[model samples]
Target: MHAITKTKPVPFLDLSAQYKSLEAEWLAAIRETGARGSFILGPNTQALEKEFAEYVGVKHAIAVANGTDSLFLSLRALGVGKGDEVVTTPFTFFASAETIDMAGATPVFADILPGSLCLDPASVRARITAKTKAIVTVHIFGYPTEMGEIMEIAKKHKLAVVEDCAQSFGALHNGKVVGSIGDTGSFSFYPTKVLGCYGDGGMVTTHSDAVDERIRRLRNHGAVKPFVHTEIGMNSRLDEVQAAVLRIKLRHIKDDIAGRQKVAQEYTQRLAGSPVKTPSLPKNGTHVFNLYTIRVPKRDAVRQALTDAQIGTSQCYPQGLHLQEVYKHLGYKPGSLPACEHATTETLSLPIYPGMPLDHIERVCEVLLEAVRG
Candidate 1:
């Protein structure tokens, strides 16, 4: 085993560093919102929706409470409810499948592609049945899925497509932004994400005006006007404070993505020829490097070595959705989805964030390589 040397611990995500850089702007925006006292769906929220829609090249963008709410609302707007099944990858966060259940629909598990670690088109095809109504494709780790193939399958099956772009804010596939490609794209602004805010926030993007209008109503208790409920909808409105913070952050999203790309490049270069298998960026897509995950043999031992070395790491989804106790009622066993199961065992996410110093990247790589070899 390699000797473990203690050093100042690196964080899996340094939101503090990012906040420090934008503290002035963030505080200013927050104070401005406080001054206005327009806390819910205020000017900042409206502006952010417009700006984000323009950035994503979508016709509409509706700000919501959080990523999961974004997914649930999108599913509901698409009329996917009781007696419907949503095909999605099991190798993602619980919210991906949980949202389908929230919409009163069944979440059918599908295996991910070995290379991209995204919902495999073939696997999705096999999972579709008479009850399948939509496909929620998660852009895991900021790598775009094979959208062209997935879209084709969706069209042939007449299923709605929802792009879970929680980790891929600025990523592109085939010269088009991800959120704009699907029927509805759900995004998260959790502090750790690439285009995160100071607190929880999310957005739903769509090309159809009707869907956009429906989501607007659904996010606010299904009321077209105050106190006149048309349908039962949850209170999932994005707060003005978060919207204000997000607006400032959204202005620099492109630069943030570039910074993450640089860090990913440095990590890839430094880890070249090491035992670890680096993340693969798709040929026809742009990767924003939300998480610089690598597959290493003896993954747990390497993770422990890095921990001992004061270097942080994470296993994003160590257990796939199918393997989770919450989803046990879905009848998925350990070997139910081989690809997702294998990925869960081998994948480990290294510290990655926008504006990460090159020295930090080097230190992480040095420790990681030594740990992997040992």
Candidate 2:
């Protein structure tokens, strides 16, 4: 294969470059944490929680171990449990549904809107039953779902609305941030997210004091006092080191999100009139540009061609959750949810992070267009 060499290289994520940019500041924060000798549930963790709560426009924000735990804790705080059904989209990351299970509830699958790739509110209405206790609408790929209608539907049904903001930390819906609109919102700080820490981190945001109390107590083993347990809870507290790193990055989040928005605009401009279908923005929401995904007819073939050309591409979800073997007992056959199935087969995620330059994105787009034409 010495005869075949790539003209360009593209990676799905360049975490190393991002880290390098903040190496000096990150190392200083880490050394300071070590010097302080307070690694868990300390000053940095508390400060991060306060700052994050204010940023999300919520009354309280509780730091958790990771995104899945954030969802599980939110469901638990809302008093969802065994035999209860939580309506959610089957077209998102598995963590959205997995957390429902972790909260001891059954996950009810719903179809997502075709254009926006978020929960279809009308479909959600049809899925509601007496057993339905809550709705977990995932803001997939950092694009906010239409929340105004979804919130109205939830209110009519007397169901709690949990915004799965794991992919949308800074996204907005109708001039308001996503995490602040729902009954509660969950976020993930995985290394690849728009606003991420050096290690795993998560947050739960809410306006209700009662719900906040539940999450606070639950993350700390259900104890109101030290060594005294009231209810059963799990160990899901954020570490001080991750909180420190997140605090440093949080100050620059607006700038980071602005950079991403600029890149997304460039992609939209360049990809216009192409055969591949580009993602559309919702009427009432601001997309944070977590992943710039598009739908194409020959998705698999184009993906392979990109890989051959040293251009990285990702398939967000190859199979819908309802069609997965784990949920076979739900009795959802292949054709039952046609929209979700179709999306799974055709959707492809492209790299669109803040660290890359405009010329790099243009090069990626050219490679992508060429691959599709072949």
Candidate 3:
């Protein structure tokens, strides 16, 4: 018999740690922005857009207020509206589908692949109808969705594709990055994201010139000139202060992503004998380790045991969107998405940051292994 030792509590994510390491750079950028008094879609914001576009390997990147707006604008610019259906995964944040509904389109739920926990190409093909206008393939937990397969499916059906890359900023699929593969790539720079800023910010990426033009106009009240409106739009511009910080962070993203990948490797090696399902390996470069999630028996019990041990944990998405109360009008039943429903019950995300300490990861695994044993 072994007596497992407990240590200090680990934070689910350490945003403060990351900030402290880059304090000098962050402060410098803030000072520069303040000195210029150029806020709100200024030079910093424009420069960030260019850097991000190049990072994602896309022709255009439009900075927006938040992730939801990034998706909403993508759908609107791609001509998704009333009487149209957008096929998307059921096991993810509600915002993925909510943005579709907000664009006045019907949200069609699709099952996920058991291994990837991402939208299944077969399920997507089954769900497409004559009225299906687009597909919003969400790269959940930073694993790039099966884009090549999905892209082929889209081409056969002539459907537009929006890569909801909220959690997959630097992740790549095949030889290409995520946002560049789809017609439009939507990103969220929420504080906890892999490339997050101090506050909320987002960007939309695309290869088409016309789509880029529409999003630029739609983000600022559909006006070609100041105080002159061509159509209806919203105020969803990324501010200069956030952009400045992002520019600094963007420079270090490659190394940060490498750190995350190393952490994931340690986790996979440590949890070798545990009777839990670890994340599947990604196809290209790596999964980027945005969230190092696993599936275990009695998941809720395991989570409780970890909590009692002063270790942080999280169930990324406890309930599928198709089964939520708000989506009742969609008329989906319990078995609507089997793979998605299965994930909702078992997925558990552990503490993972770019530079997460090895001792902390060991403690997390020890607690998790013990809980699953019982």
Best by TM-score: 3
lDDT tens per residue, model 2, 1-374: 11223476878777787678788888998899999999988999999999999898999999999988999999999999999999999999899999899888999998988898899998999999999999999999989999998999999999999999988889999988988998999999998888898779899999999999989899999988899888999899999999998998899899889888888888788888988888898787788988888998889998988887777888998999988899999899988778889999899998877867666787778778987776
TM-score of each: 0.97, 0.97, 0.98
lDDT of 1 by residue, 293-355 (tens): 889889999999888878889897789888788888889888889999999889999999887
Per-candidate clash tally: 0, 0, 0
List the candidate 1 regions with Cα displacement exceeding 4 Å.
1-6
Error of 2 at 189 (Å): 0.6
Cα error, candidate 3, residue 270 (Å): 0.5
Choose 2 or 3, whichever is better by lDDT. 3
For candidate 1, the clash count comes to 0
